[model samples]
Target chain A: MCEILRLAFAAVFVLVVIITIPTKSMGADKEYGQYLSAECNACHAPSKKSGAGIPSLNGKPVPYLVSALLQYKNKSRKNAVMQMIAGRLDSEQINALAAYFSSLGK
Target chain B: MKKISRRQFTNAAALGLGALAIPNIAVGAKPKVVVVGGGAGGATAARYVAKDSKGAVDVTLIEASKRYYTCFYSNLYLGGLRNYGSIGHNYYGLAVNNGVNVVHDWAASVDAQNKRVKLASGSSVSYDRLILSPGIDFKYDSVPGYSAEVQSKMPHAWKSGTQTQLLKRQVLNMRKGGNFVIVPPTNPYRCPPGPYERVSMVAHLLKANNPKAKIIILDPKPKFSKQGLFMDGWERHYPGMIDWVDPGAHGGIKNVDGNKMEIKTDLDTFKADAASVIPAQKAGAIALAAGVNDGDWCPVNPNSMASKADSNIYVLGDASVAKSMPKSGFSANSQAKVAANAVRGELTGSKVFPARYSNTCWSLIATDDGIKVGASYKAGEKKIDVVSKFISKKGESAETRKTTYEESIDWYNGMTADMFS
Candidate 1:
């Protein structure tokens, strides 16, 4: 009985850690992405249609957004402004942006 | 799959229990935030604080004008590329959708210690935080013979309203082969590329309407923004129609007779058919009134955009002494986000993110010809520092230029919505 109780507590502990870790870092908070998206909204407004060749970011798949941002960061993408903006973003920020924008599509 | 989902829900439930220890907002009284000016910086900040705070903060925007005209694209309107209404933005979206209180009144004075602002209508509003983005005010005395009293005649047209319309009318009315003189202000003016773009647009109008007419720019500074590009575009499109005379060549503008429409340069007195005299500038009068100004502009804490003079006040846009950042709408909008985050975090205990900023200034030399310069910024220890930058190359293809021009049209739509909607 003692061993079984210990195992149950350990499972709860592991699960809590798994779920709460992202919140502690502030990147995974949907609220943070919503706040950060204010910057992107300056150019990619949801209400306004994209101009020139500027593409929309709302409702895009997470993998596609992440990959595109990564390509821009790595200079594989051709746009000068995108490369400059993407170069400043880290992995977590990119993930957060992708997740936030994807969720907005729904 | 059901068992796994049940376990995940249980984990989240336990975490929610732990989060109960954190204090939520006090429900009875909401904090009040007052923003002055409804331009790029003020509108964006007011909208963000209201939207993100979600009724936790009351936001009031006090602007003198009911409609804000963006100076960024006013040059296009001069060349008949865009209509006057196309560049004007209203505050209805901010009021109805975001729940921001939009009051069209001038902020006459700021009482910093009392944390309230007195409007021109004899009404006053109190606030927990104040944001001032009153933009630039010109120093007409900076020029030898220029003053505010004579603006109607020379028509600075720098503020982009009736003055812009007046200048356009003057351009349209000039006689054939007449000269249009432009006297640009010294360094640290609004939109470093603005006077140059004005030259291009004026030249475009002249080339179509009055081919024999000439446009001359008497620049105080030896070199101006996008000099080579503007010169190249001029040669190709409006060859010999424009002459950008540097200080060395023109010597100096000794005096200007607005009544006679003559500019007495050291070289000679050249009478103009019409002229635009953009004088030196200072921070908007309100910043100085609030005692936040260092000399001509207010110093800000780079990370939060909080006024160094007063902690409860934040300054943005042309009124701020943001190091290395030009006084453009894009820069103002970028700074507004940073200030909004800081304001929200302070008043509501929300998580504050690192301050990031970016600005892109696009100029149209002629129709289907556009160029841009931009930089990304990060909040550094002392100031906002540029992380990376890019400018349109000299020899870009015509296709590229056309695409860039189209992109600017898109950016205007997005930016205005970002500020108001």
Candidate 2:
């Protein structure tokens, strides 16, 4: 009976681990994205009204942001500053930033 | 490949559960943060602490003036590009939206040992951490024969507001073909490109209205920031209208007779219809009272912006001795975020990230001609060191310059909103 009880406990613990790992990783990525967003906020605003001549990045679609960043990194975008900034970001960081900005409300 | 067995999975899960159950000891009471000087640094720090902490930290901001006129764009105001109302900002949004306690009063002194501040209103406010961003104060008598009494005649206009308007009025009132003299401050001053931008704007005004009016820059420094770009634009747009005299050529300034509107240099005396005399600067007085200063400026840890003298005290913006960062509003705003994060982490047990900073200074030369210089920085062993830098090219097309000018306007709007709203 003790052997059976130990097996059940192990199965439940394994199930919890399987559930928690991916969620925790996702949460950490979002947090890191928030940190990186601090720099972007210096130019691309998060608030409504979009500032004068600057676009609002809040609530942008993840796919759209990803594509735009990739284009900037590939030198398709004309802005030298944007190209430089985008070139520094890797794919994982790009996805994280997109997710973070997309999660915000306009 | 070896696979994780059920026993290993269970052990890891149990450890994770134990870690989750451990309570955070720093979560006992709300921590209080007091910030002095509600300019770019103080305002951004106050807003971020109040907003991000989500009621975990109480923030109080003390500013002497109710309305803050930004020193960044005051030159544009003088050039008639922006209005007085546009450059001015108030603390109302910070109080109502961000939940910051905005106290419109003078912060007289800092009691560092006790971590309390004494206000001019005779009240004392205590804090768990203090942030001082008191900006810069002019070194009195740095310029010979120049004092507060002579400001009305040769306005510095460095601090913005009424002084800006006064300088603009004096420029407008000058006779046609008259000379306007600008004595830019020595090195390690606020806004390295500022005097040159003012010269550009003044020339812009003269080129249109007072076509024959000439601008004479008596620069103490041999070479100024963005010298190449500024000289290129000046020659292109306002030829024969601007003459820059370096200290070598002018033999340095000797004295100024404000009564006669004349400047006496070792080489020759120059009489002007309008003049701007910017003096050398030091850290604001409160930093010294707080005992956070090395000499003229406060020394802070580059990573966290915490005072090297006292860990609980943080200094940001122009008053802090940031080694590689130019003293500008954008640099102050960037430093504030790094400091804010460190403060929040200490008080609220939030995760602290490595510090990263960036600054871009944009200057409008003509109506549509703009140039910029900027860099990204990371905290190094001893100071914030530059990582990457860029400057506008000398021979950019008109369309590119206009776009750059537009971008600066956007940045102004975005940065202000980020600080206030």
Candidate 3:
């Protein structure tokens, strides 16, 4: 009985640490990403319904956004507006944006 | 395949309780931000700072008029494409929904050192940060013989209020086969493409109503924004009805007699039944009174939009000398966002991003015929320099032009919503 109780307590503590650590870091990243993404709302609509022709960034996969931004920075993407915007962002910013935008619902 | 036992589920639930142990960060007092001139710049700046700060900052907007008539699409109103009421926006939504204190009063002057503004009502308001977006005020003497007194006869409908209505009435009531003269101001005026767009709109109005009427453009600059597109549009839509005279061809405007409805140039004197003499422009009077102006405009840092004279005050829109950015509503709105972010970052513990700006000016020539010129900009050491630019070609498919026109309409709606709502 004593051994079982000790095992349950240890399992719960490990689980809480596992869940809380990533959540805290991601929460901070998402908040900063939101601040950085304000300018993007000028051209790219935040919602899917209003983003015809202009691509909607909300709820996209993180990898897809990272790839797209990288292409824009590398000049593989042909849009001048995206090129100008993406050229200013670094790798950390790109990851944060991807994480924040992907976390949203369409 | 594998199912969790009841004890495992109980352990997972117990783990979730530890997630709520994070302490809340303490923020002491609210910072106050005051914005003057509730146009595109002021309205957007106030809304963003208030909404994004999440009650961390108190924002107040001081505008002389309750109803703001945007000069962006007023030309379309004259062309009969848009109604007069469609271009006007109110501040009720900003006040009620966004928690912005909208004061309908004129900002008479600013005490930058002490960070207080004196209103026309004799009340003074203090602010931690001040945003001045007092759009352009015309230089009355820029065009000889044209002043406030003479505006009744030959209107300069640049401000988009009663002047716009008067100009529209004059255009509609022009005598048959009469000439309509448009005296475009020199460069560095509000809305570089605006005067030409007005010419296009007037041409459209005339072509439909009085087909025999002619339009003569007396321009100070040799070329104008979207010149190729406008020339193409005029030829395709209303050929032989428009005549453009550059400075080289017709010398500079010598004088104007509003009563006689005659404009004299070095080459010849032209008479018109109606005329729009858009005068040269300068920063709004309040900006000069605040002692933030270099000459006719206020200089600002491109990255932060902080006034060169005073760090506490930020100047936006046509009133500031933004080196590469054209003085348009879109540019103002863009600049407002940058300034708002910087201001919020300073007041709150929020993160700040590098400044990037963009603007697209759209013009409608005739029904479903539209063209646009746009550029994306980044902050340089000295100015906001353009990174890339695109313009509509002279000849494009009807479908493309139609799409561009529709896009402009959508943009107007979206931009107004962004500013006021």
Q: What would the TM-scores of all predictions be?
A: 0.91, 0.91, 0.85
lDDT preference between candidates 2 and 3, better one: 2
Clashes of each: 0, 0, 0
Task: Please write out the lDDT profile of model 2 over residues B1-421, one tens digit for every residue.
Answer: 1113522543454455334323433455567899999999999999988988888788999999999999988999988899999999999999999999999998999888888999999998999889999999988588999998899999999898899999999999999999999999998899999999999999888887899999999988899999999999999999999999999999999998889999999889999999999999988889988989998999899988999999989999999999899999999999999988888777765656678888889999999898888888889999999887788998899999998988888888888887888
Candidate 3 residue A102 Cα shift, in angstroms, is 5.7
- What's the TM-score of chain A alone for every prediction? 0.70, 0.75, 0.71
Off by over 4 Å in 3: A1-28, A43-106, B1-28
B91-191 in candidate 1: lDDT tens per residue? 99999999999999989999888999999999999998899999999988888899887788788988989999999999999999999999999989899
Give the 10-residue window scoring lowest on summed lDDT in candidate 3 chain B.
Answer: B17-26
The candidates, ranked best first by TM-score, are 1, 2, 3
Q: Rank the candidates by DockQ, best first.
A: 1, 2, 3
Greater DockQ among 1 and 2 belongs to 1
